[model samples]
Target: MAYCPKCKGEMPQTAAQCPHCQFDFPVESPTGEGARTGFAYSPLADFALLVSMIAATIGSVSTAIGSIVAVFHGHFFEGLFIGPIAFFLQLGMLVTFLRVTKLGEEKQ
Candidate 1:
């Protein structure tokens, strides 16, 4: 279930060299320090996502309140602006979270 680094081919678990490309494989240490494992969540990315989500939530709430107040004040155009901007910001944050999560998964 291992892949040969040189030939990019499937090699047997006990393979020392890639049969297809005659490339020598790096022997893994008994401590398992040489082989690359699965992907992990990066703390910085997670922190950024958390912050974005919080900001998006706050922005959305504020936008709703602002739009409602503006509507009551007869400022239709102002309400329109605030509502769309808030929605766009929330959508952007959701998309960002999804993209980063997908990237982390793919790296595994």
Candidate 2:
């Protein structure tokens, strides 16, 4: 599904014009490029999200690696006990972030 920018009405993706507003879908703008699609997009927000996801992924992997190393190095208490816990917590947070962000945008 797609949305009409004019009326913010829900419409079929193949719609040529908004049924509610009768706004014709632009085939070419004065700039000679086709109309842009979708709404509520922000480049800065996207970039920030990209950076955050990358960092979170790195952190999660490092925790797992650290845990394995600690156990092999005879630090079984910290490696087995603390490493898995920390890694799982970070992973949960990352998943939560992704879900919330996606839901928030859709509800907007």
Candidate 3:
């Protein structure tokens, strides 16, 4: 099984498009290797991904704590704003990390 880069949906290796999102797989060469469609992975990309994931984790935890504290202190608006921001930031980081790692694995 392989993951679709666009939708992150699981698909069979022989699938031409993602069943969930209809994302077309890149054409393969006659030698059976898929063509590159995005950034080539490097040691630098791996390092950046690691750092980003760590930062996102820390940020998410801190923001969640802070939001909870704010709500306890009667700052509803602040909690509301901070909570969603943290959630979206963490979600973005997770998706980015997954996509980069998946693409990197394909190269190997």
Candidate 4:
């Protein structure tokens, strides 16, 4: 799907004009050069991913430290369980976010 820049309406990828606003899309010349419609990079999503990664890193480190403290305090069960679980959960979340956004795919 593509968005109509003029009317902000959703339309099929094959559409040459916006149905809602009747805005015609620009045609490419015979040389095959025209305006590109999609984005090369989304700054907003990138920023979000950066922030999430930072948060996850901090959380994982803290969890590890907390687990060590717990072990030193003779709470081995709590130390072992909480740290790995939190770390893996954050890692899974990061993976899911990356997959959902398709951020690293090659353009072809």
Candidate 5:
């Protein structure tokens, strides 16, 4: 599936025009700048994606290490607490990233 670049409306991948907004798809060039294979360019979206990815990586690593260390050091109860905390942390980051993408689509 593909989305209309102008209105972000869902459509068929082979669609030449958006059925909802009647927006025409641009011709495919060698560079594919207007290709239907991906999301349209948005500076804010790019930055948010990069930052969120980095944060998620670091946060996950630390959370894992911290949880393991706590359990091994006789802090089993603390390890239990850390599990849910880390889960929420990751969930929040995911939500934030999704929100940014939605905003980017809306502003495009």
Candidate 6:
């Protein structure tokens, strides 16, 4: 089974037009309103992007400031490891979220 690009309804693989929504899968009627195969950006991705941005900002600022303060206070060992580790973990999480979002949108 294949899914309609517009409505995401399952249809026969050989179907050219979606029976559920009557959207033509490949060809349009020259009016340009019925081209159903075009990719649409997911709203969920927008939310994810906002969340990731916030996470990154919080992580970076906290980590950097924490490390700097620790170093200035003469706690070199703790600052050298904990701060950068936290920042990098947040960065990795942001990248992974972005990649998953893009892949999900493309598959739609």
Error of model 2, residue 83, in angstroms: 0.5
Global Cα lDDT for candidate 5: 0.74
lDDT of 2 by residue, 4-104 (tens): 99999998887889999998976434333233233424677667767777777888899999999999999998899999898898788789779968865
Tens digit per residue, CA lDDT, model 4, 1-108: 889999899987778888899999875453232332335235776687778877876787788788889989999887888767886787777677667457354322
Residue pairs whose backbone atoms clash in candidate 4: none
Candidate 1 per-residue C-alpha lDDT over 32-84 given as tens digits, one digit per residue, 9 for 90 to 100: 53343433335765687778877877877778888888889999887888677
Cα-based TM-score, every candidate: 0.48, 0.51, 0.55, 0.47, 0.42, 0.47
Task: At residue 96, give the lDDT of candidate 4.
Answer: 72
Per-model root-mean-square deviation over C-alphas: 8.6, 10.3, 12.6, 9.8, 11.3, 10.1
Q: lDDT of all the models against the reference? A: 0.75, 0.79, 0.78, 0.73, 0.74, 0.76
Candidate 5 is scored at a TM of 0.42
lDDT of 2 at 39: 43
Give one clash count per candidate, in the order shown.
0, 0, 0, 0, 0, 0
Candidate that scores best on lDDT: 2
Best by TM-score: 3
Question: Residue 74 of model 3: what lDDT?
Answer: 93
- At residue 2, candidate 6 shows an lDDT of 86
TM-score of 2: 0.51
Q: 76, model 5: CA deviation in Å?
A: 1.8
